[model samples]
Target: MTERPADEKDIVLAAQRGEQAAFSELVRRHQRRAYAVARAIVINHEDAEDAVQEAFLHAYRAIDRFLPDQAFGAWLHRIVANAALDVTRRRKVRDADELPETVASPFRDPAEKGELRARLTEALNTLPARQRAVIVLHDVEGYKHAEIGQMLDIPEGTARSDLHYARSQLRQVLGALRQS
Candidate 1:
């Protein structure tokens, strides 16, 4: 007889008990989505990857505090989002002394890059981290308001408002892109 794979609840229970393999399973299962969340926030692939790694490490250490009844993915994504935002903050501080104009932009590297994506990325960066995260989670990742709220540790109504405001800001900023 073939063995059934352990369910998430069981995995969470085991991980909370200090089982290394169970935590490893959790990491294996959620790392890709975590990377996507981090990537949406950080923009840079290297920074996103680092954020994902740091989030997983923090999750592992904090696993004992996690409740199996709660949604593990949401909890993990929250950590991933925070880590990604930290990277962006650190990067801004590190680059504060230099003008961005002095460096060649990734946007200009490929002539075929979509103008809309570039414009959208810039617009997203202008918003507050929470608002940016809400918009990306809702529109780009297709997460519902409640799920986004849970992942970001905000109220569902706040998530909705954030998304609405973020969309309005992006629309205003990128209005020229639509015209062209």
Candidate 2:
């Protein structure tokens, strides 16, 4: 008889027992979502990559302490979010001196789309970090407020309020961009 592949809980269990390959499998399975969570916070590609790598390293180190009763992905997502926030905090001083670059979009007129993307990025960056994270986790990633609260360590009501505030801010910013 052939052996079936291990499930997530089994892989996590194996990893907890010091199986490196099992942890690698978990990373491979969840890397995209991890990266997305990191990127949504940090906003820069290289910083997001660094944050994800850092999150994975942190996760690997703590795997032995992981409880299999909770969802592994949720645990990882929270780590990634925290790592991204750390990266954002560290990059603030460095970012002040960096010039912004506009990428031309092939789908729309280069200038218009590039300008729009830049404006949107600016709008997102202006929000308070918690609000930004809440909006990104909820609207962009389609996570529920309860899940966001769990990941962010906030009350569910706080997450909902942050999302409301973030959306309102973005709408005002985007409206100004449209008029100008």
Candidate 3:
């Protein structure tokens, strides 16, 4: 039989058998989305890159135990997201004085677009980490609430509540920005 390109199941099996090449292919397939998810959560490019690297390493180490039926990309995304969250938590605790600043973008019309981006970032920063993660994953990253709940290990109801709360907070922040 001619050797065909391994499907996800084949790759998983090969990875379980300790095939590093198969594992590398898995990483190549999911790396961009994984990094994007990490970047959204961590918000710092360097930190996100580090988190992605750590996540991939963790995934490789843990792949043998991964459920065969689960989508590997989603599984990897969860790992990356968790790693990013850890980075955020550690950074926050390490430097309480180094709170994130909302800087206006220079490329857009300085008067309008800059203010909008700043206000959005401010509102996002105000949310609890879980809520922010849910919002970014669901709204920004285009994951469904169920997928987000699975990735974050939260109940779907909790994810919904977080999304609602995040939306409300952003609205309030935008209103305040308009008033100011």
**TM-score against truth, every candidate:** 0.84, 0.87, 0.85
Clashing pairs in 3: none
Q: How does candidate 3 fare on TM-score?
A: 0.85
- Model 3, residue 97: distance off in Å is 5.0
Better of 2 and 3 by TM-score: 2
* Whole-model lDDT values for every prediction: 0.84, 0.87, 0.83
Residue-wise lDDT of candidate 1 within 31-127, one digit each (tens)? Answer: 8899989887787799999999999999998998988898899899999988988988898899899776676453443345585577778788888
lDDT per residue as tens, model 3, 70-116 = 88888888888899889899888887877558875545443865767
Identify the leading candidate in terms of TM-score: 2
Best by lDDT: 2
Tell me the lDDT of model 3 at 119.
65
Model 2: lDDT equals 0.87
Arranged by lDDT with the best first, the candidates are: 2, 1, 3
Model 2 segments more than 4 A misplaced: 1-4, 96-111
Model 1 scores a C-alpha lDDT of: 0.84
Q: Give the Å shift of residue 164 in candidate 3.
A: 0.3
User: Which window of ten consecutive residues has the lowest lDDT sum in model 3?
Assistant: 104-113
**Shift in Å, residue 126, candidate 1:** 2.5
